[model samples]
Target: MDEHQGTAMKKKSSHASAITMNKDLEHWVSSEEQADISKVIQERLKDKKPKGKCDICRVHPAKSICIKCGNSVCSSCYFTMVGLCQNCLSKDTIEKWKNKKTDWKKILEVDWVD
Candidate 1:
C-alpha cells in the first residue's frame, strides 16, 4: 500500500460506482428524453445560417449553396459547365486562356445572365 496503489484503488472504485449508476439509470431514458435531446440539437443547428451572397453572380440574393466551392451563390448564379457563372469557372479553363485575361463572365445558361 503506497500512494500510487491507493490512488489506483480509488480510481477503480470510482469507475465501478459509475458503472453501477449507469446500469441503474439505464431504464430512465425514454422517448420523451430522446425528443428533448433532438429539440436541443435542432435549436443548436437553427443558429447556424450562412450570411452572404452567391460568390459567382453576386447579383441575385444568395438562396442556393455550393459545397464544392464553399460558396452560397444565389440560385441564378449556380450555373453549369459551358454555362457556368464567372465565379464557377474551373481553374483548367482559366489557364487555357493563357495571359489573355477576361472579366468575370456570367455563365450564359444562368437565368440572370443576358
Candidate 2:
C-alpha cells in the first residue's frame, strides 16, 4: 500500500478499537450504575471543601487556599490580588511577585488532579 493508504488503515483500525473499548466499558458499567457512581463522586467532592477554621487565623472559615503553601485561609487572611495567605506573604514575596497576575483557581486546583 501507498503511505496514504497505510495511514487510512491505521485510522480505521484505531477507530474500530475505540468502538470495541466503548462496548467493553458499556458491558462493565450500565448507565444507571454510572449515574449512581457520579452521585457518589459528587458527594465526595462536596465534602472536600475546606471544612474547618482558617489555617492562619484559626477563627473565620477558610474562603481561599494558598497557591504556594496549600493552606486554607479566610478572606481576611488571604490577599486575593496576590493569591497568597498571610503566612506566605512576606516583603520578599511581595517584591518577587509584584508585577505578576496570579490564577488562584488554576494554581490551587492543581493538587486535586493527582
Candidate 3:
C-alpha cells in the first residue's frame, strides 16, 4: 500500500465542539443571592467545631490530637510515643518505636524552605 493510503489525514470540521453545557444542570444566580449564600456559609463555618470523635475509629471520643496532622484521635488510635495518628505513621514504624518516645516538637522547629 502507498504511504498516503496507509496514513490517512483526518479533516477537522467547522461544526461546534462536542462539549456543551447541560441546561438542566445550569442555574442563574443573582449577585444578591450569591452574597447571602456566602454570608451564611461563613457564619456556619465560624460556629462549627470538631466532631470530637476519633478520625480513625469514629466510635470513641477523641482524647488527644495528633502532632503530625492535627487529627483528633482516641488513645487506641494514637501513637503516643511518636506523637502521630495511626493514619500518619506506617505500621512497621509504629511497632519499631512502640516503647520509645520521640521529640515531635522538633518537627515543628525544622525549616521547610529549601
Candidate maximizing lDDT: 2
TM-score of each: 0.27, 0.37, 0.39
Report the lDDT tens digits of candidate 3 across residue range 1-114: 776754543122212222234443366778999799768655654544335889899999987776656677898898776666888998887787676676656768865554
Give lDDT tens digits, candidate 2, residues 16-91. Answer: 9999998887876789997997686556455455558999889999987776677788988888986678788786
* Model 2, TM vs. native: 0.37
What is the per-residue lDDT of model 1 for residues 42-70, given as tens digits with 9 covering 90 to 100?
A: 56545444447666656667664443444
Winner by TM-score between candidate 3 and candidate 2: 3
Tell me the whole-model lDDT of each prediction, alpha carbons only.
Answer: 0.62, 0.78, 0.69
lDDT for model 3, on a 0 to 1 scale? Answer: 0.69
**TM-score ranking from best candidate downward:** 3, 2, 1
Query: Ten consecutive residues with minimal summed lDDT in candidate 3?
Result: 10-19
Clash pairs for candidate 1: 54-73, 84-107, 85-107
Candidate 3 TM-score, C-alpha based: 0.39
Q: Candidate 3, clashing residue pairs? A: none
